[model samples]
Target: MSPASSDAQWYEAKVPPPLLGLAGLFLQHRLAPAGGGSWPRRAAGLGLSGGAVALMGSAAGTFRRRGTTVDPLHPDRAEQLVTDGPFARTRNPMYLGMAAVLAAHAVARGGVLTWLPVAGFVAAIDRIQVPPEERALHRVFGQDYADYTRTVRRWV
Candidate 1:
């Protein structure tokens, strides 16, 4: 989702590529040695991505069941107002979880080359994906949703 407003207004800074670069290196090399042991590490990445998909899918399902629509591009739909499970801690826990998995992939095998792409991915999501969702929510939920926004963070 796109960021409706500049994150720079609230955040002090963005993450540098180097840190993300390291995640890539791990993704590519599967760091912690690579000659023999591999199954557990590989499973970890799969698990991260898989589990996140499930959780986010569940969130989507909840919205669907409630007769609400969820946009892949925004955080605005919640006809029943789900605030449980992964959602309780992070306002956009699904996205946060998915990002963690992607970052893990970078770490699992991306190395230095993965940094720029990862940063760009996050930026695009912030600028293009999140705003419409927020805007849609502003229309659907109105004041009650706005109040929730005041208490919860957009992302953790």
Candidate 2:
């Protein structure tokens, strides 16, 4: 049987990454009420957030087109190792996009302390959500996955 088909432990996060990004947005506002980010920073933030959304959408579309599951909580349900589109750039494009959204918010908030939430989000997803997904993928895809990991980065 395929490793992904096995009854592996679920590596679900208590809070979804998007929700965490939302929390970070709120935290950024709370941390700096008078956030007057420069126009350039705000523009850059807007661009980054937009790009992140596009990256996430492309990755999800890739998964759907390949007939695989996009749910991070159920990596075991994945039927493909998706290596094109955003996957070619980063293994965890969804998570990376979420973190990028938070980082963009932080950038627009205009304070060093406002970045804390972005850091927290990245840390939580990387440490908690990514490892199990990698293991499950490795179990299922084996050497192919190892080869993919060698060629592609986890996050850029």
Candidate 3:
């Protein structure tokens, strides 16, 4: 489905972070797994599963330092606006969480069916939610945001 019609209204958010978030999700489910069945599919599942585990570490670190919030687009209101932990690497750990969740689900299911959740995650985060958030962060942090931007990669 087009992200425009999705619940997140991602096009409305108009944020680049969310788009990248969803792309990562899609890559995990749609492209990570290859073939229609068994061996090849299982290999993809292992790769995504491993990636998900790593994301989990990053997610935990982010929450520990920044205080995990359900909202992805309003992190400037974050308890600490952490520059350390996972925030040191990505501006949006929540999106990473969402992507990790999708990957885990695909790994658990082990088939083309896994692709659906990944696509949904991308649509939800990228098109539906993140744009307005980045703007809010920029408004709140200003040049600090610029400095943070210069320091970190959007995603790893």
Candidate 4:
């Protein structure tokens, strides 16, 4: 669907991404066999997952502190154009964090099929959620948003 289209489906515009990531994690565990990996690999996976969580928390906290809306469904309610902290690195740190959590699960699980969920979550968010978010931010912030987009990658 087009980013500015108001006729977007519920899954495209309403479903929270954390739920999708959780479903993806559930599917990965249900579909893939538990993988065997070295302790270091597992530790790295744990660290990645923790870091992802931290990134998301930081992003949310930044929004809250800046008095901006954290609800992705209501981008127009944002009071400020957040560009510091995690936003400085990537435009969608929260979404990236969700994807990273899935990737961490896949890494720890050690199965090729596990990665499928990660890819799926990324694709769904990128295609369905990010477009509208970007459009709204650009509409609200105009040239400032455009400049930020030029400097920050959407998903890094």
State the weakest 10-residue window (summed lDDT) of model 4: 4-13
The digit string of per-residue lDDT tens for model 3 on 78-149 reads 555556766777876656755765666566446566666667666666655656566656666688877987
Clashing pairs in 3: 8-128, 10-127, 10-128, 15-131, 18-126, 19-126, 22-122, 73-133
Q: Model 4 misses residue 133 by how many Å?
A: 0.8
Model 4 gets an lDDT of 0.86
Sorted by TM-score, highest first, which candidate order results?
Answer: 4, 2, 1, 3
Superior candidate under lDDT, 1 versus 3? 3
Which regions of candidate 4 are displaced past 4 Å? 1-13, 34-38
The candidate that wins on TM-score is: 4
TM-score of each predicted structure versus truth: 0.61, 0.87, 0.56, 0.88
What's the TM for model 4?
0.88
- Compared with the true structure, what per-residue lDDT tens digits does model 1 show for residues 1-156? 345344322222444323443453344454333353356656676777777678767766666666654544333434656555555655666566556666556544434554445565557556755665566667667886687778777776
Q: Which candidate is the best by lDDT?
A: 4
In model 4, how large is the Cα lDDT of residue 118? Answer: 93
- Write down the lDDT of every candidate, Cα atoms only: 0.56, 0.83, 0.60, 0.86
Ranking by lDDT: 4, 2, 3, 1
> What's the CA error at residue 155 for candidate 1, in Å?
1.7
Error of 3 at 103 (Å): 1.1
Model 4, C-alpha of 67: deviation from truth (Å): 0.6
